[model samples]
Target: MSRTIISSNVRSYFASLWTATLYHAIRQSNWIAIAVTGVFSLILFIAAEVSPTEGTWGISKASWLSVCGGVFASFLFLCIQSMLSALKATNRDMYKAAFNELVEKHGIKTVFSQRGSDDVITLYRKLLSSPRRRIWAIGMTNKHFVDQHLESLVHVLTSYQIDLVIAFWDPSTTLIVRQNGGRARSIIEAQSALEGNPGSKWGETIRQRQLRIANAVKDQPIRGDVRIVNVSSVTSFSCFIIDDDLFFFPFLANTDSTNDPTIYCAAEGSVGRSIIDHFTKLLQNSEVCTTTYHQKETTVVVPMT
Candidate 1:
């Protein structure tokens, strides 16, 4: 009972001390006070560094000062430049300017509102799911639209030889195990470790997803091939070319898919052709993915004997 009472008293004292300190801190907090304190602190720091005691440091005083001064000057310059840029043109203004430039250059016409996923889905179906379909697409390593909304449409493309330029990552060992089967994941992780980058498992699940699609393509009744090229780069946009129609989906950072804008361009237009050409360039730089395969089975019936 005595020990418990003492412990309670000790806690109460500390709580009171904290409360007093917080009260004083809040009372003293002011812009003028802060500025004055900062200036004095800077001055004291400078004096202490320059008026150093006799010490045999590796770097000479002059050389160290010169290097520190240079770093400070560079940092100051960058801060000033950033402030000027922000003042001159805000991020919103820059985005508007870029949008206007693109619109003017491409003579773009907004077909549908760039608002929701449904809008994009409607446009995709109208363009890609026609009786006669001709399409080429460039998208993220693991494209959600393709995986989620367009699964049924995917089987149709199995009859046509499609080209894919995917931005794939090196997946981590844990992720590989979670996604792929245990046996396959163990082998993959062991092989990856042997290559001297055990922790380099950036995009294993995405690669596996793409491989699944590739294998599915190979299984179609009409033999169709999807040539996958894996590139190591971050993509800010996804492009799909259906016949002469082009759809562009901008990747919005820190936003859900429902908020991201999907743009549609006519194939005969200059903007559409330019977008297609850009996708072609991306395709040219990617490394071919030759991991997935489809094994054909044969069945023979014996004559009545």
Candidate 2:
């Protein structure tokens, strides 16, 4: 009775261990390794069990079994490693596809070169040629951009109603200190460095330029609103959304917006829709001032709560 009890206990321990091990292996989805291991194990067992009455091909059963056993062990180890590699690769592919699936499908064009196939100015000209599209532009109200892409800008401004968001963060409080420490001088310093006596000339010059552009948009034959938003906290990415088409580029800490690589896509697609939604949210949350020029000039200042 004692011996039987001890035998049963030993069998139960092994049964549980085998069950756990098999469960873990299957759960890992190591099917190839498991299949190969089972087949090799069966072959090894057969070779060991067969007793050679006579030599076949001048090799004894003992030698045959020894060679087969070593080969089986090697193969089992290789299969397990292969299975791990396969799993890792599968996981990596999934994440890579999720993040860059749009880039792969739509293709990312670099606008680094002005004369290349990926030139942004050329692309802008091509995209903005559609007269039916509503244009939404968000960036620093830099006139240099307008001058460089004059033809495209003219087409867009004249073609349809243009919704423009100009950045209005205080230079002294925000960009001058945070982003352009040495490269940018304070208003006081710049005034003092002037050819004449120090005054509010620098500030006036900036205000005048901003007003000039706002007035230009207001005077256009097509109707649109020029809005000012504080984007110091949100982002420095410049975006140009032409109807369903969108082109965006990020401003690096020490680089120009024009030099940055622009990403373009149709706003109706998943990625584009998400981008459009985000833009709309930003607009909703940040309307510091708006000037409309449809029938007549109308300026509305949204008081910050």
Candidate 3:
């Protein structure tokens, strides 16, 4: 009788253990639990069969317990698997919904045409979910010319209420400029020329051109909160974020007629990937991706800061 009671308690314990394992597996979407429970059940079944006193409880009772335990375990495993599948489906649906919302709100015509579209989209959705407002523009700068993309950039920054703008200057192109006839200038010098050019009519003409560009997009004003930063230095990380919203990187391309502008806009593969990796680390903590309008092969991953 004592043996019978002990066996009964053991059966009850396994039943409860299996039930708890099932609950956690289903709730947390953990697959490891299924394996653990299966192993544990196997061990229990082997012990029952090999124990010398098994017949003392009667073969009928032992068989019934074995069947019940197997059935319960199987049921729990199936239920957990079903729940996990459902959970995955639900997550995909939620991501799709959020992406659609972003498109409607910001007028994002397209996203993620590259190798890691799913991952990129997931990161993008996470970043957009945040309350922070930031915009980042990646372009080139050199001694002779600054890429004229600033006008479009200002419009984007303003629209996003960006608090900062990080501009990446590629050193490789600048080296090319130095090798050529032109010399590379510091960011401060470039910025001074841009914002506080000397009292020359030429400077004034450039400023007027800038103002006209700004005026053309009167519908979108530079956000009062935005500030420009020129990042001429390259670190282990190259990506920069404006208010945690936008990411920018330089891409290697064919240089134009003027050697000076080459450094300002030339894209170097090594430098570009380094910058992307850096930003990927930063954005991943918050779950975001660096997306582009024209490129289809690039994938942006947010890295750890």
Candidate 4:
């Protein structure tokens, strides 16, 4: 009777151990390792219980079985860890390779040439000539101040017969204008106000202003006309020109409260060169201006002129 009771207790303990191990493995999503360990543990438990010899070499069969079970479990756990490590390494390599390919295919190059003041102008010229779909300029202003600048810009473009559009955003207000006659309002702002009720944060406000500007330019009345859009912040003015047949050009300005005469220009030249190359291949004229200080010296690149 005592022998029977001891054997039953040993079986119950082994059963509980196996159940706990499986529970943990399942929780961790390691089904394969759990299965292997469970089968081996069951086999060890059975061998210990059914063995005819109660004691072999002065050690009980159950004691040896317990030790073997522990070693097997440890080995299986190591195997799972090894598999997970290998998978993680493979994923990391794939991500790196993908990123490198994208950079090679579409990454823009920066042109760093010239020295001192000339260097800055050269950089600006490059940016102005770079081929791009759109450019965005930002600055600072009040309602009347912006209107004055907008009138001047429209007059200049009209004098050149360049098709254009103007978009505006001021907190809860929005407006759009084209040469012929078209107007729209701030849908994004309205939606944002309804859904999130977001307060006036700098980033959010800037984003809203940009969105309104982009929408106005995109929905311009002309089908194939190039767009030159301008906007401002509290301290600066920005200009963006999107030309389908020409390279992109951008002009930025910081209002001189201290009465300084210095102006800065940032241009993407390598992109401009690429665009010129494409046009040259197609036997088309691609004229672009590469200059930093429009006030000091104007550099204009006209087609073979």
Whole-model Cα lDDT of every candidate shown, in order: 0.51, 0.54, 0.41, 0.39
Off by over 4 Å in 1: 1-107, 111-116, 131-133, 158-202, 286-305
Q: Clash totals for all models, in order?
A: 6, 0, 16, 13
lDDT of 2 by residue, 228-260 (tens): 443333455667777777777665543233455
How far off is residue 246 in model 1, in Å?
Answer: 0.7
Angstrom error of the Cα, residue 250, model 1: value is 2.2
Show model 2 residue runs off by greater than 4 Å. 1-46, 49-59, 66-92, 95-97, 100-118, 157-237, 247-287, 290-305
Model 1 quality (TM-score): 0.44
* All-Cα superposition RMSD per candidate: 22.4, 13.1, 18.6, 19.3
List pairs with backbone clashes in candidate 1. 170-201, 170-202, 171-201, 171-202, 172-201, 244-267
- lDDT of candidate 4? 0.39
Estimate, for each residue in 172-199, the C-alpha lDDT of model 1 and write its tens digit: 2222354446434432334345444354
**How does model 2 score by TM-score?**
0.49
Which ranking of candidates, highest TM-score first?
A: 2, 1, 4, 3
Q: Report the error of model 4 at residue 130, Å.
A: 18
For model 2 the local lDDT of residue 252 reads 51
When summed lDDT is taken over every stretch of 10 residues in candidate 4, the lowest stretch is 289-298
- Kindly provide the TM-score of model 3 when superposed on the true structure, using C-alpha atoms: 0.26
